[model samples]
Target: HGGLVAAGEMTRTYLWRILFRDQVPPETALLLDNNAEFTGTVRNSRTLWQQDFEQPAPGLCGTPALQGGCSLALDAAHPHSTEWVIPARPGQFKWVRASAKARADQMEWDMNRMTQYVIRFRRGNEIVKARTVRLQRALVDAGWPRELHFDVRPPKADFDNVSVTFLYYGTTANLLLDNARLEAFDD
Candidate 1:
C-alpha cells in the first residue's frame, strides 16, 4: 500500500486529480532499500537482498519499528540469522557507512559476540573481503536504542557487491535492528 490504495487505484494519482496531493519526497539516486520499509509490491532496484518482516515471525516485530515497519529481531529462543546485500558502486564514493538502530531488550547479559553484522565484499560468487562488527557491550547495553554504524572502505576496484549478515547464537540475549542504511559518501 505504499503507492497503491484499495480498489486497485494509485493514491498519488487520485490525490493529484482531486488537487489534494500532499508533498512528495524527492527521488533519491544513490541507493534503494536504505530503509526496510517496502512490501513485495515494490521492488528494490539496487539491493540484491533486504528484509521485510511484515508477517509475524518468532520474536520479530515485537516492538514498533524505528522507521516504516518491523525491525529485524532475534531472541535466544530463535537465534535469527539473515543477510542483506546492497549495491556497491565504489567508483563514485570514498567510503560506505552501514548503520542501523540496534538495541538489546535487557542489559543483564553479555552483549558482545552475542550479535554481529559481518560485512562482505563480493565479486560474482567469490568473496573478496570481509569485516565483522560485533555489537558493543557498552553502547548497546545502555538500556536504550542507539544508532550504530561501521565505516567501511569499499572492497577493491572491481568489487560490485557489499553484504551485511546478522548473526546471533546466544542463549540469553535478545536483539533488535531497524532502519538500516547503506550510504556511500566522498567524505
Candidate 2:
C-alpha cells in the first residue's frame, strides 16, 4: 500500500486524533507560525491575504502553512494567484482540511467567486500530480465552510520532505485554515 492506508481500517482512533488536533504535542515542540509574513495588497477592488498555523483547535484540520510553516502567501506580481502550503509526514497520508466558524463567510465567497482551489504536491526535484476540490454551493449557503478531505500518497523517492500547495484565484478573499491531520490508514 506504500503509505496509502484507509483511515476507516485503523483499529484505534488515537493516531487519527493526534494527527487532526491543532494543539502541539509536548514531545514535538517545533511548531512554526507562517501567517505572520503575509503582505496584504488590494487590487482592482479585490484583495488577497494569508494566515499561519499556530496551534490546532479542537474539531479543525489542515492549517495553512506557507513556504516556511503552514500559512498563506500571495504574490502581487501575479494578481490572480494565491498559494497555501501544508507540511506533513513524508509518506502516504490522509488529510482532513477544515476551517473555523469565524471565517465562514469569506471561505464561502472564495469557493464561489473564482475557480476552485487546486491541491498539489512537491518532492525534492519534481512536482507530483495535482488534485482539486470544488466548492459546493450547499457549503456556501450554510456559511463559508472549510475543507475537502484529501488522501494522497507522496512520491517514495523523496521521503525526506514533502509539501502540499493550494492555488487560488487572485480574487479569493480571506480564509482561515485549522485542524489539519494526517493519518495512517489501511491499504
Cα lDDT tens digits for candidate 2, 1-187:
2132224433232244346665523212101101111113312221112234443232222234322234332223332232444554443343222221222234333333432334445554355644444332213333334443333334444433333333335434444333333333323
TM match of model 1 to true structure: 0.60
Worst 10 residues of 1 by lDDT: 28-37
- What value of lDDT does candidate 2 attain over all alpha carbons? 0.33
Residues 1-187, candidate 1: write the lDDT tens digits: 2331224322343334335434332221001112211212322223234454555465667466655667777766656555666666557565656666776666434434457666778886578877665563324244477776555566655777787777776624456777666665554
Off by over 4 Å in 1: 1-59, 64-69, 76-78, 108-112, 138-141
Against the true structure, candidate 1 has what lDDT? 0.54
- What is candidate 2's CA lDDT for residue 121? 57
All candidates: TM-score: 0.60, 0.36
Give every collision pair in model 1: none
Candidate 2: segments with Cα more than 4 A from true spot: 1-52, 55-119, 135-138, 142-147, 153-160, 172-174
CA error at residue 112 for candidate 2, angstroms:
9.3
